[model samples]
Each structure stands twice: as C-alpha cells, then as structure tokens.
Target: MQIPEVGEPAPGFTLPGTTVRDGARTDGEYALAAEIGRTVVLAFYPGDATPVCTAQLCSYQEELDDFGDLGAVVWGISPQALDSHAAFAHGSSLTFPLLSDPAGDVVRAYGLVAPGIGLRRSVFVIGPDGVVRWRHVGLVGLRFPKAATIRAQVEQLVA
Candidate 1:
C-alpha cells in the first residue's frame, strides 16, 4: 500500500494500546476515526526502548503541551506488544498513547514497513477533516523531525 499523501484522507485504523492517564497506566483501543474533528499525530517507530526511538518520543513528550495547545493529539504506533509498550511508556514518561500493531497491519497500511528493519520512523499529521496535512518518513531511521517542526505543521492545520 502506498503512503497517504498530503491532501489525501489518512488511512484509518484502530489498535490496542497503552496510555498514561491520571498517573496510572490504562489499556484501551485507539481508533483514528474516533479522533476526527481534531488534529492527530500518528508516529510510527521501529521498537520500544530503542535509543533513537526513546529520544524521539521523549522529545515529543516534552513538547506535548505545544501540540496540545493546537488541539493535536499524538499517538505512537509500533509492532511491540502491549506489555512492551506499557513498560516503554512508563519508563520514558510518555503520556500519549503507545499503540501496539503486533501484526504490522497498521504499519503496512501506512507504508512504513522498513523491509528488513521492521518499521520506519515516520510521522503523519492529519487534519480535523481527516486529510493528511504533512508527513515525514525517515529514510535511514536514525533521525526524526523535532517536536517544533511537527507542532508548526499542526499549527498550520489549525490556522
């Protein structure tokens, strides 16, 4: 499947995930369609607790308020199991949902499966209208866009 381009409707998906709510870990399903009417950030990473992935997500968490200020909610997707996601979210102090796509179904749907590496580090910003407003798919999986950059894209969606 091809990655959804800017101006195209983002591929909708629902996946079981872990979230930190009220200082507690909660398990639930996260559905993209349910987040309609709000900007959604879909972040696909390779694994849980990996150095680069850790840094990328931690940075996002730190700037989460900026995204929230724009009414954008961020969701992180990975092939790791729910247990791993829960532990990673706790260890990294991430408040966003960490979705588990163990089957790689959602990953493949987003065209983010990195042939031999599992999944590529990618971020897609979806507008309130369900259209993709911006995206960044890392070519080498060694770097990710900073939170400020993504926040700017979300800001545009709201503007």
Candidate 2:
C-alpha cells in the first residue's frame, strides 16, 4: 500500500485515545474529521513501553508545548489495545492523545503497517484542510523524526 502523500486527504479514523495531564485524565475518541481545521500530527509507532518506542514518545512529551504552540494536535497511534495505551500514557506522562488501533485498520489505511512485523514508525503531518502535508515512514521501528523536525514540518504545512 502506498502512503498517503502531500495534497491527499488523510485516511480518516476515530480511535480510542487517552491523555493524562496535570493529574487529570481524559479519555475519548479521536477522529481525524474533528481535526479538520487544525494541524494534526499522526504518529504510528510499533507498540507501547518498548525501549525505542518509549524514547520516541517521551521526546514528543518533552516538546509537547512546541507542537501545541505551532497549532498542531499530536496523536500517537499504535496497534496496541486501549489498556496498553492507558498504561503507556500514565507511565510516560504523555499529555498528547495516544490512539489505539488494535485491529490495524487505521494503520493499514495509512499504509503504515510493517512488512512482516508491527507498524512502521510513521508520522504524517496533516494540514488545516485535512490533507496530508508531510510524511515520514521509517524503514525501521527505532528511527523517527525528532520533535524539532516534526514541529518544522507543521510550521511548513501551516505556512
């Protein structure tokens, strides 16, 4: 499957997402259509709590304010269940939504599923009009764009 490219509508998804911030935990559905007028950073990782995945997500957390300041909503997607997602969110102190795609439907739609293993570490920067503006699908699970790079993409998309 081909990854959704710039100028293409992103594959819509309404997945279960949870976020805990400042001791308040909120759980709800995260739908792409709902973010139509905002920049959305859709990051698809392999799983929760793995060393590399943990580092990648924590890096996002460290720069969460930068993403928000750029007027972007970042959601971490993985094929893990909501239970795993909840645990990961709580343990990692991730303020951004972590979406659950246990059925792999959404990842498949985005053409992000890995060849023989789990989901490829992928990031899609969607613009305010709901079209994909930039994308990075890592060949391996461990490599991914840093928070600064992702913010730059969001800025470019909105510019």
Candidate 3:
C-alpha cells in the first residue's frame, strides 16, 4: 500500500482509542473527519511499551503543549487492543489518545505495516483542510519525527 502523499487528503479513520487523564483511563472513539478544522498529528507505532516507541511517545507527551500551541491535536496509533492502549497511556502518562488498530485497517490505510514486524513507525501531519502536509515513514522503525519537527510543520501548514 502506498502511504498517502503530501497534498493528498489524509486517509480517514474512526477507531476505538484510549487516553490517560489524572491517572485515569478514558476510552472513546476518534475519527479523522471529526478533526477537519484543526491540525492533526498521527503517530503510528508498532505496539505498546516498547523501548523506542516508549521514548517516541513519551517525548510527545512531554512536549504535547507545544503541539497544542501550534493548534495540532496529537494522537498515537498502534495495532493493540484498547485495553493495551489504556494500560500504556496510564503507564506512560500520555495525555493524548492512543488509538487501537487491531485489525490493522488504519495501518494499511497509511501503508505502515510490514511483513516481519508490524507497523513501521510513521508520522503524518494533516492540515486544517484535511490534507497531508508532511509525513515520515521509518524504513527500519528505529526513529520518528520529534515533537518539535511536528510542531514546526503544524505551524507552517496551518499558518
């Protein structure tokens, strides 16, 4: 599957997701279409609680305010269960939603899954017009875009 290209409409998704708040887990469904008027940061990782994924998400958590300041709504996507996402969010103190894509439909939509491993780490920045403005799909899943880079793209795209 081809990853959605820049200037293209981001693939729409509505998945069950989980987030942490005040040490409590909140579960809900998130839809890409629901965020049409705001910048959206979609971070797709392999699973919950892995070392590099942990670092990536924790960095996002630590700098989430910057994303908000840029008018971006951030979310994490993985092929785990909502329960797993809830646990991970609680453990990592993630303030944003971590979407569960157990069927990998969203992963396939974003062209993120590979043969051996599951989801190759990927990031997509969708502008307020619902078009993809920036994207990075990791070749080896070792690294992803930092929050600052995402914020910059959000500012540039939404400006």
Candidate 4:
C-alpha cells in the first residue's frame, strides 16, 4: 500500500493500546478523526530499547514542550508489547504517548510497516484539518528534525 500523501486525509484509527510510561490504558479511542482539529505528529519507530530507537524517542521527549507550544500532539507507535513500551517510556522520561500496534494494523494503514520488520522509521504531520502536511520515510541514519524544521511546518498549518 502506498503511504498517505500530503493533502490526503489521514487514515482514521482507534487502536487499542497502553501509554508510554504510565502502563495505563488510555480511555478514549485514538482516532485520526478525533485529532482532526489539532496538528498531530505520528512517528513510527522500529522497536523499543534499541540504540537508534532510544535516541529517537528521547529526542521527541526533549522537544515535547516545543511541540506542545506549537499546538501539536505527538505520538510514537511501535510493534512492542504494552509492558515493553511502558518500560522504555519510563526509563527515557518521555512526555508524549507511545502506543502499541502489535497487529501492525495501524502501521499498515499508514504504510509504515515493512514486509519483514515491523515498522519503518517514519513521521507524518497531520494538519488541523486532518490532511497530511508532511512525511518522511526511512533514512539510512534517521535523525529527528530539528526544532526549527518542526516549527516551520507547524506554523504553516496553524497559521
């Protein structure tokens, strides 16, 4: 399946999952439809506890405030189980939500799932109106975008 493109409506999803560090089941269903009125940053990492994954997650944590100030909600999705996600988030002190997509249902919908591996490193920025505004698939040595890059894109949507 082709990845959703910019200006395309993000595929709606209500995935069952647990929180990053809290180990608590989030009450409300997580759906792109519900996030329509706000900017949503959906990031998919490989697995939990790996070196690259660790740095990627921690970077998102460190930039939480900046993302919040831009009025964007950030989320990380992986194929790990709830317990593992919880441990990783707790150890990293990540502020955003980390959800489990063990079945790869959500990941597949976003076209982030690799044939053999779980999820490809990718990030999609959804506009307030629910259209995908930006996306980046796997890079050899993927690095999270700098704060300025994030701010610029978000400002365009929020403006």
Which candidate gets the maximum lDDT versus the true structure? 1
The global Cα lDDT (0 to 1) of model 4 is 0.77
The residue-level lDDT of candidate 4 at 66 comes to 80
Report lDDT per candidate.
0.92, 0.87, 0.90, 0.77
lDDT rank order: 1, 3, 2, 4
Runs of candidate 2 with Cα error greater than 4 angstroms are none
Q: On a 0 to 100 scale, what is the lDDT of residue 123 in model 3? A: 94
Candidate 4 clashes between residue pairs 3 or more apart in a chain or in different chains: none
lDDT per residue (tens digit) for residues 19-51 in model 1: 976569899989999999999999999999999
Query: Can you write out model 2's per-residue Cα lDDT over 52-127, one digit (the tens) per residue?
Result: 8999999988988888888898999998877788788888888888888889899899988787877889889999
- Candidate 4 contains a number of clashing pairs equal to 0
Off by over 4 Å in 1: 21-23
- Model 4 worst lDDT window (10 residues): 20-29
Candidate 3: where are CA atoms >4 Å away? none
lDDT at position 1, candidate 2: 62
lDDT for each residue of candidate 3 in 35-129, tens digit (9 for 90 to 100): 99999999999989999999999999988898888788999999989888888888888889999899999999888888898889999999998
Candidate 3 or 2, higher lDDT: 3
The predictions' CA RMSDs to the true structure, in order, are 0.9, 1.2, 0.9, 2.3
TM-scores of all models? Answer: 0.97, 0.95, 0.97, 0.87
